[model samples]
Target: MCGILLHHAGDDDLYHLKEQFLEFPEGSLSSKRCSDGSPIFNSIIPYISARGPNYSSLRVSKKYKTAWYSSVLSLRQPFTCQSIEIEERYVLQFNGELYNHEIVHNDTQYIVGLLKESAPSIPAIIKKLNGEFAYSIYDIQNGTFYFGRDTVGKRSLSYFLDENTGEFYLASVTGSQPNFIDCTAGIIYQYSTRSKKLNSDLSISSPYEIATTMDQQLTKLPNCIDGLFEHLNKAVHRRIVSIHPAHIENSPISILFSGGLDCSVIAALICKQLSNIKKEKKPILELLNVGFENPRTGMLPKDVPDRKLALSSSEILKNLYPDVTIKLVNIDVSYEEYLEYRPKVIDLMFPKQTEMDLSIAISFFFAAKGSGYTISKDGIKEKYQRKGIVLFSGLGADELYGGYHKFANKSPDDLAIELTRQINNIYDRNLNRDDKVIANNGVEVRYPFLDEEVIKFSTMEIPINYKVNKMILRKIASEKLNLATISDEPKRAIQFGAKSAKMTKDGNKHGTDILTS
Candidate 1:
């Protein structure tokens, strides 16, 4: 949600080459001119100002000869605390949330407080954190830097290291860096003396025990439908109540709803949770569905099921939860608009994989860009004044619950093994792409299905037949939750469902040239 820049000034003339290292391209989104009309990228090494408008702070460490800069996008808490400093010997630049901080302490503290409790053993500290985060801490005493992220890799971290000059650049945003290397989650990088070398040590796995507990609970229950429904409900409740008390009031929650089973389930849960909260003014629910149209026909592409299901689902949700204000914001995108923003999307995305992945990123780009509300009656002209700061995504549900058609007709043994593999490796498959696209719009995305507890139950405890293409999920929603509208909604890939791929192909054929030069 925010931007952070960290650099190590180790006996090099960084000031002379600052422009070469910090030049912002013409179309980059993160780097911008400050209030004083000076670009933040031109700031002094290790002393760059914060990146976003939410909160900005700078800290200088004479002891370690380092400077830390953080632009905080307030997620669950405010910006009362500064950089993470332990005994004035270590300072951390952090960029994510700590979901389990409440149980650790009942104070207005952040991961810094939790970190102090688990100090002296970095691996132990990493294991204790049950949230999405990416951070770099400098050890003033040892003259070394440590970097880490969560197991799900929900936060992006990249670094540029020049061994010959002992120069280092690390940041949470990877705009257009030339030779930056991606940091893997669940591993702590311990940068030794600048001239020596860099090494890494594996961190501990997620401390999720919901799988064993869910199995035991299901044994006691009469049927599997009740068991899955109960566990999912608890998962949704935890995510909503986990936000800091200060952030809950007047902070609307946005759901990337396509009217499919995954998103419909999330929307229903949020509606139920919000209706029960004891607040004077209830928070509004914004359901965003991106609609793609044919450039020639000026209508939604044929075979796009999202439009029909999304409209019906919105109507049902509104009638079901009248107390909570539910607004359906439909973003109708044309091929011309798709081509116009295609390069910006691709450039911002960095295109790490194949064209198929890039198409998915394009679909997500429009979805994220369409997060805000509309001021005009047309509803296509988005206003920057978005009421929702926190967006919820049903990302992990597909991988965990076998929502893909490929998982159909598989034997019990094969299904379980494949499900386990997909759940474990999901961080690499889709988290980074989705995380970057969503964060580019200055919104923080929370995944209820990816919560440690939800992951454990859906992947390990759910029975094989129930897990086939989310059969158990549909049954519970239809029979128990009474969500028949979305119970049997077929899964549609975002790119195809939103017609993003078709738009790109049509634009290219008509000589529109979607990629920016």
Candidate 2:
């Protein structure tokens, strides 16, 4: 949603700080300054600014010897700037949405008010937040700095420390800087501004409670499907609403659709929602399917498994929901085009350079770029660039519902442990990498399945029988959603489904292997 950066230092080291750990190139550093005439620690963050190109601001508190920088994409409000001061005391740089109906206009101002009410209890406020976010709040009163992300790391935040100078640096991203690490999800990292030490202590635990036994079997088989269905329906609706009116020509919402069970089920829910809205206000649903051509095998993008399945599934949805309009965007990537963006995308995926990372990021990179084709009136393969800035991804379904192939072999006890492990670690493995790649194109990706309510219902309430193969979701698709034939679509990785894998051509190379380059 936005990019944030902060640096804290003492008087002795404030002016003498070197770029050993937080260096930027010579000319890339923006000469931008704060409200007054003073500069903002001379912030150098050209790498992370792509995520928020709409507006950029830098605020410096020379009294506190701290610099705060933020750039905004402005998806929620046209003029809601960052580094928002709560009652002009607590300085906050927030990136991501806060889905509370009571606070309508700006989430930052609303959150600052919440911070005021709870004064310094950060975790208490974090527990009340039901949406995805990554933020840093500097309590000018107590000189204690705090930063963290939502329980489900839906946004990206990276940080580093200079041991020699005791200067600390945190940003939405600091590209390829050695020892610069991603802040873990579900943690409140803090340090005292008075001390000016570079070390960060685990401030406190988060609100997430993983179920040791993944299944409760609380709801009977008949009602299990209904419970999950209702939970997911509300989740999808929460993300879908609050879209500002049709500012773009076509639509503002899209799904990173592969025609798989996870994505198709979301599409079905959106279609039903779309049907209920009036005809004049209908927001077109754009389903984006990406495929890659294989130069070595002489295979074309159209022949890719993802392309075939997407075309097949489009017809089923069309036949089932005649009233709703669905646009299937066939995004074909030639071998040369994939090579063109590979270097930049890999740069965006920083600190995570694996053959598997490239394969997965490549699919999302093109999908977020949103340059593809849709059938025009004349049935011509017309050139179309997706106007939607918000893309829905079916990311957390596998971790939450045991949709992975590896989950098939594990016993119920082991399955419970593995599911907990994967979901917790998803921040570093998948969410962080995906956020950097997708947000690099100035688009926001939301995962409805990862919503707190949805995750709680699926993992805690649903039975193990329904969790395996994600039978509950399949049933919802078949009976509840009325996409009968789609229930058979098995789980497939985007790399294989989109034909982006095995292109590294490292003979018998595994996905976990680090990139040779």
The per-residue C-alpha lDDT of model 1 at residue 193 equals 53
Q: Which candidate is the best by TM-score?
A: 2
lDDT on C-alpha atoms for all candidate structures: 0.65, 0.75
For residues 1-517, write the lDDT of model 2, one tens digit per residue: 6888887764443533222222222233343322222123343356556777776666666676776777776665545777777775788888887777786766776777788884558656766676878988888887877888788788988877665555677877765556777988877777665665533445334434345443355457778788889988888887766555443224657889898888888888877776766656545777899999976556788888888888878878777677676788989999889989888778788888888998999899898888999987687998888877888888988888889998998887787778878887888889988988888887788888988889888767776656788777888889997787878898899999888887745468888888765
After superposition, the stretches of candidate 2 with alpha carbons farther than 4 Å from their true spots are 10-44, 118-120, 197-219, 246-250, 279-281
Alpha-carbon shift of residue 109 in model 2 (angstroms): 2.2
TM-score of each: 0.82, 0.89
Task: List, residue by residue over 150-268, the lDDT tens digit for candidate 1.
Answer: 77777777776768766676766555446777777677888865444777756657433213222323453346667667777877787777666556676778888788888888888
Task: Kindly report which residue pairs in candidate 1 clash with one another.
Answer: none
